[model samples]
Target chain A: NAGVTQTPKFHILKIGQSMTLQCTQDMNHNYMYWYRQDPGMGLKLIYYSVGAGITDKGEVPNGYNVSRSTTEDFPLRLELAAPSQTSVYFCASSYGGASTDTQYFGPGTRLTVL
Target chain B: EDQVTQSPEALRLQEGESSSLNCSYTVSGLRGLFWYRQDPGKGPEFLFTLYSAGEEKEKERLKATLTKKESFLHITAPKPEDSATYLCAVQSPGGGSYIPTFGRGTSLIVHP
Candidate 1:
């Protein structure tokens, strides 16, 4: 079903450059999330959306912004990127919340900010 | 605050061997504990979900059990294909948000 797809499997950015990581789901799910996995660290949520037009910040959202303008798409924006933002980003979607159901994750995008 | 900790940062098992990976957590109130398998350079794939103490679930050669303070993912008759990083996550009730707290994960290497 192409559960969840993330664009730019790999990316490189300068310290002050900005870029948006695009994610899309074809499962018609109601929940979508953006998470970053640093080396030797667990995936940390950056932002999430419950449904179209509704979004919220997560554990590590200071350098990121997100928008869910459509049920199928959720985009995470990195502004004035820093080396700290260089991590593998994954986009996931679920039929319900983590407390209720399983989440499907994308292949992930490896971002390197120098 | 919700937190998850997985034990045995890395494990190596011989073919036909059986071992268990541990995931311990602390939370205001437990909603669910999840297990996922992540291959190198790939995102995590969901494995099992344990909602309460004494609850158990199994798939193929993998079995997951939960307790009030921790969860165990038991692997039986390991194979090279089963080698990967096993992650655990917890969902707490107080956040008003549904984000789950994840552990650093246990890297499993099953040698043939």
Candidate 2:
């Protein structure tokens, strides 16, 4: 199982620019999540999806949006990039929505907003 | 609010020197605690999960123990290859979100 995969390992965006981060999982997980990790900080949830066509905001979902069109794909969208959004982004998935389920993470995408 | 705090932000140890990393947390009705190891430029790999206080889990040279308020990851006779950033997280059963709150992580460097 390829586990989870993310695109554009590294990206640089200018102020006000918009982009979409793509994530796909082959494990057929029912839950998918997007998180950002800053230097000297823990991973903060940005958005999550419980299933296809069902999405919800996470802890830091102010400038981000997400869609789960298929069980294998969950994409995160940034409407307006800012310097504060520069960080490493990770996509994860789990078989279920319970706390006991283990999440499989992707390689991560490093974003630099100038 | 649920919070996780890890100590000794960074630690350097000689090969064969054992050490323990601490993760303290505060939450309402704890559901689970998790430990992960992350290498540079890669995503984190799950190590262990503890469900309740007094529970312990081990893999290879690493052992994780959980308590009512904290969790400890102990490395025994570590080698240089075992160096990585160790992260701890906690999940509560409240609010119906079931999201895990992670710690800043403890960076470990083993010198040969």
DockQ scores of all models, one per candidate: 0.67, 0.71
Q: lDDT tens digits, residues A1-114, model 2?
A: 889999989999999999999999999899899999987787898988889999988889998989899999999999889999999999998876554867789999999999
Over B5-109, each residue of candidate 2 has an lDDT whose tens digit, in order, gives 999899999999999999999999888899999999888899998999999999999999999999999999999999999999887865686877889999999
> Candidate 1 chain A, which ten residues in sequence have the lowest lDDT sum?
A94-103
The 10 consecutive residues of candidate 1 chain B with the worst lDDT sum are: B91-100
Clashing pairs in 1: none
lDDT of 1 by residue, B1-112 (tens): 8988999999999988999999989998788899999999999999998888999999999999999999999999999999999999987765676667889999999998
Model 1 DockQ, alpha carbons vs. true complex: 0.67
Q: Give every candidate's TM-score on chain A.
A: 0.96, 0.97
